[model samples]
Target: MKKLFRKILKYGLYTLLALFISLNLFVILSGRFYLYKGIANTYLVGESGPTIYDLDVFAYSTLEKGQGEDLILAQNYNKQKLSAADRAFMESMETKAFLVFKGDSLIHEEYWDTHDKSTVSNSFSVAKTVVALLISIAVEEGKITSIDEPVATYIPEFKNGGREIITIRHLLSMSSGLDWEESGKNPLSDNAESYYGSDLYGLVTRQKLITQPGETFNYQSGNSQLLGFILEKATGKSVTKYAEEKLWKKIGASHDAYWSLDKEGGAEKAFCCMYATARDYARIGQLILNKGKHKGEQIFPMWFYHEMISPSALNTADGIKNSRYGLHIWTYMAKSGQVNYCRGIKGQYIITVPGEDLLIVRLGSEREANITLDPARKGDKNYIESVRNKVGHASCLFHYLRMARTLTK
Candidate 1:
């Protein structure tokens, strides 16, 4: 009886060991561990993915220097006069950096938690706007014939996948009808695959169509990846190379920037992963305010710049109520006028308020949702209720805009 019991126990232990080995081998061989590693590092383990503020931290080609001067800060401007309540509010948001520019002079600049002027953090989806800017440069340089041209014109493999109908404009406006389940919780979703996988082209190209192109507003990171592929093909240069030559080099950037790639010497992960300083991001806002001309040179066409910030007829036709999206940029209707901005998840903003001649940049680690803010006041009850229902990030955006208005005031 004792011998029989020992045999049973031995077989059970052997089976458990086999399962463990098999799982580890599968993770290593399939390369799906990249996704888990990324998630673990960024979300679970609380390690920020990459930093390249002061110097290039990733494999990158250089942006040649243009004969332009670094942006100057105001000498007499109020630099440290935030009320205690306001300072508490900003601190509660886990803000890393906050910058305000009135006209061409930086007014207020502050950083928290060891983040200085030279600290670099991931821009998250704000990089999408950078890609949009690059697309405009491509069009202006005649690398791309027109935004209305079908994407398949550059990416021939997409011609037969019912993706032929997708256009450069569709991708820019994020109306591409690709089948991407953009769930942060689902590792198998397209967002995770593009974020962590090595083969950006293969992952994006395999997606099937779900809706008619240019019909409605659908936000998908894969759309940006597809746009990156098109940009690469159209210019015969990687997105980073094109950006360096056309935009970054001309902008008088204060420091070298980094865009994370899928792997070493692989395509850039264009949907996200641009690491730049807060001041440099402010330069992008200034460039947009100047109508794409930087330092007496036309970096991107003025018409394309206008189209990037202007709300589209398609957005209106689709009955997108209270929407602010426009050609990969976000818009806010202030009483002074409309404000165009680029935003990233977890509270990164490059806001351009042309009406006030203002640019506000905020970068942070963790973002506070409206629901997580102070107890709902009587006036903010509806907003609180909406946040409770997970409607959107309206409250956080409103928070930033309110803070920016103080600068103008």
Candidate 2:
């Protein structure tokens, strides 16, 4: 009887080892190990856990700092030190850096988790808004005709799979209607594969159309990836190069930024993963606050900037009763729906309130909580649905906005 039990245990152990080996082999061959490495470096906190900004994964394209003036820096200029509650709230969310701007001055700056002004981190989906800015510039420069132009005009590969119907505007507004299951938890989902996959252009171009384009709002990262491809084809320059020449160099960014490529010398991940410091990210918000002008130079056309902040008619018609989405930019509608910002997973934010002439930036490694759904608010349906499609919750956004109000006041 004892021999029979030992034999059963031995077989069980063998089966477990074989399963482990098979899983590792699949991850290695399929390039899904990026998901594992990303989680280990970003989420895991301890001595051996590396910072998200410092991850040495794919090849990166560096955005060199041009001969631009540094930002006007300040600390506790307007408000007192962060209250114990506010400080605890920010720290509890694992905040790495926080900065606030009123008009053109940096009024508050704080750092936690051994991160400082110079430390850079992955901006994640916030980079999507940056991509939107680039597309607007491309249109302004006549590299592309218009935002309403068909995406297939640039990438003929998109002429099939019912993708020819999608316009550049639709992609910018996250209304591509691609048949993508963007699940971070599911390794087989498009979101995970895009993050971990080696072939971004191939993965994005092959996506099947789930619904007609320009219909309803469905936030998918594939839209931005495809847009990146189109932008590259339209401008005859890589996404990184155009951004460096047009936006980054013009903005007077302090530190060198890096955009992770799908592979060495491959396409940039326009949907996500632009590594930059909180200070430089704030500069982006400042541009928006200044109506796409930097040092008296009209960077992005005022009309394009207006469209960026405006709510889409399609969004409103689709029963999306919130001021929560714009042209790749996120919006919050309090005090007459006048807030625009860029948000990222794991608590990265670049919030701008034009009315207040205020900008707030927060970068963090840990997500705080799921979204606080308010049944009383009509917009929460679409807002929560959009949040459900992302990698993390919307709870941090509320906290960030609340913090911004306090700081700005």
Model 2 misplacement above 4 A:
1-12, 21-51, 74-79, 315-319, 368-393
Candidate 1 lDDT over 238-305, as tens digits, reads 88888888888789887777787877789987887787888888888889888888778888888988
Those runs of model 1 whose alpha carbons end farther than 4 Å from true positions after fitting are 1-33, 39-68, 315-322, 368-393
* Candidate whose TM-score is highest: 2
TM-score of 1: 0.83
Give the per-residue lDDT of model 2 (tens digit) for 1-409: 9999999999999999998798789878976666565555445544232336653566789888788667785555646467889889888888898888888888888888778988889988889999999999999999999999998998888788788888999998878888877654565678766776678988887888887777677778898888889889999999999999999999999888999887888889888889988889998999999999998999989998889988665543334443557799986665544778888766788988898888999999776654444557646666666543222236677677677667766
Pairs of colliding residues, candidate 2: 333-337
Give all candidates' CA lDDT scores. Answer: 0.76, 0.80
Weakest lDDT window of 10 consecutive positions for candidate 1: 49-58
Instruction: Work out the TM-score per prediction.
Output: 0.83, 0.87
